[model samples]
Target: MQGILVSILVGLCTGVGALPFLFIKKVPQALKDGLLGFASGIMVFASSFNLIQPALKDGNLLSVIGGIIIGTMILTFIEHLIPHTHTKNYDENDDSSVLKKNILLAIAVAIHNVPEGFAIGVGYGTGNVSTGLSLALAIGVQNIPEGLVVAAPLIEGGYPRGKALLFSFLTGIGEPIAAAIGFFAARLTDKLLPFILSIAAGAMFYVVSHELIPESHCNNNEMLATYGFIIGLILMIIFRTVIGE
Candidate 1:
């Protein structure tokens, strides 16, 4: 019960992040690049250490590899079926295009969030609420930047502040929902934990490599972005050490 509550509270950080955009007029491109790079680093670290490494410990190498490959393929299928564009290309004059890009990014973030929620749920389902709380706390803190990532661009692209924040909030709702589902799923198939974890890591890897990295380095602040990535990577490690089991 406590674990579930913590997860919801952590998820709420998404809204906290959007609160800043409500008062700000414009988001600098360098800041955006740095934020994106930070996110990418966190993703890479979490996917590799927190997720995939555990799978390697518990599951056969082949199964873990297969899970990763299949996960990547699933995201690839989504990419083709629904195109995603950066905030830059779409003109503010074209409301439809701007909205489309916003929606796409929202969906992408939502998809990426599912596995994280599941991991939290799995922690609770496994009767380790302490670890779940730690994981949720880390995710919640990370979601702050994600909220900025989601809402800032929409503001720049012409969406009303309230509407942009709403969209960002929507992306976060996926976490609690997925958390519930993950708890149930984990209880039913505890033995399959490693495979499931591996798959989620793979999906995250795809997101970082395909979306976050390119977006961060797309502009002139490439070095700043790299520095941001290092900081994020270190943060993730520290997060795991301090709060995680």
Candidate 2:
């Protein structure tokens, strides 16, 4: 129950992040790329330090490796199966293009949130309050940028602010659902915890490499994206240090 509540709060951070879009009518391309980059960096750190490292410590190498492979495959399969728009030529004037891109972004973000929710669930299910809280905190913070990533393009593409924000918030709804599943699964089998953790990490890695990084660097905002990534990384490091202390 507590875990689910925490997961809900973490998931809602996506909506919270989108709150800024209410007042701002247009989002700059550079800012959008930077937000995406920031999200990528946060996910990378969470995947490494929060998920995979801990899994390695708690479970065997084989399980961890297998989980990672399975996780990556799952995401790959979803990407291939889903019919969403993907293109480098994003013309804000083209309503069709904008709609397709927004759909794609929403799908990607929703998919990414599942593993994050699972991580949170696994942490709490393992009876580690600190672990659960840390995962929630990291994911929650990262979700802000993710929300912006979802809402910005829609707004730029001429979608109403209310609709953009709704879409962004809706994409995060998957997290709580996945969190419930993870919590139950973790409670059922302690032996699978590490593998599950690794799976979540792998999924996040896929999102960063396949979705976030590419999107961030696509529009000649590579420098801003890179800096955003660096800032996110540093922020995570600081968070970890403070938490450790």
Candidate 3:
């Protein structure tokens, strides 16, 4: 129960980070690209260092490898089934582009957050306070920048500040639900947990490559995007090295 609460708290950071966009009307293009790149970096590093590594330690290497393949394929299938629209499909100058991007981004983030929330709960359930809180803190740190990534476009695209933030908040709710589920699942079956963790890693890797990175580079600010990705990657690597170890 305590671990579940902590996981929910970590999930709530999504809303807290998004609170800033409530007053802002526009975001700079360079900043937007940077934020996207940063998010991509975080997801990539977190998936590789935190999720996959831990799975390898806990389970057979073959099962973990299979989970990774299956996870990536699952997300890929979802991508095609959804057929979501995005800013690139419409003119950036168009008024509706921002809303479109936000819609798709929110959906993707929400789906991913469930696994992340579960991971946090499982960390605590399977180990101790230190394990749980460390996972929570890492997700919480990433959520701060993610809030910026989700809200910036909506504000510029004519969404009222409140509405944009509301969308972000709603997506964050996935964490608590998954966290509770994870806590229970880990306790019920030891064999399943490792594969689930690896699946999460693969799903996140797909998102970073297919979604966030592409979105960042879509604009002319490729250089800023690259710089942001590198910085974010370094930060997450260091963060994982310290906390996830």
Task: Give the whole-model CA lDDT for all candidates, comma-separated.
Answer: 0.75, 0.83, 0.74
Superior candidate under lDDT, 1 versus 3: 1
Report the CA-based lDDT of candidate 3 relative to the real structure.
0.74
| Alpha carbon deviation, residue 210, candidate 1 (Å) | 1.7
Q: For each candidate, give its TM-score against the true structure.
A: 0.86, 0.93, 0.86
How accurate locally is residue 218 in candidate 3, as Cα lDDT from 0 to 100? Answer: 76
lDDT ranking, best first: 2, 1, 3
lDDT of 2 by residue, 80-197 (tens): 8884544476676778877887888788888788888988887788787777777888889888888887887777777788988888888888888888887887788778989988
* Candidate No. with top lDDT: 2
Least well predicted 10-residue stretch by lDDT in candidate 2: 83-92
> What does candidate 3's lDDT look like per residue over 47-159, in tens digits?
77667777888898998999889878988888887656544677666556655666778787777677678777777666656656766776777676677767777776667
Which runs in model 3 stand beyond 4 Å of their true positions? 93-98, 241-244
Error of 1 at 111 (Å): 2.7
The candidate, 2 or 3, that scores higher on lDDT is: 2
User: Considering summed lDDT, which 10 consecutive residues are worst modelled in model 1?
Assistant: 126-135
Expressed as tens digits, the lDDT of each residue in 95-213 for candidate 1 is 78777877888787777677677666765665656646655765776677778878887887767898888888878777777778767765787678777767766777888888888
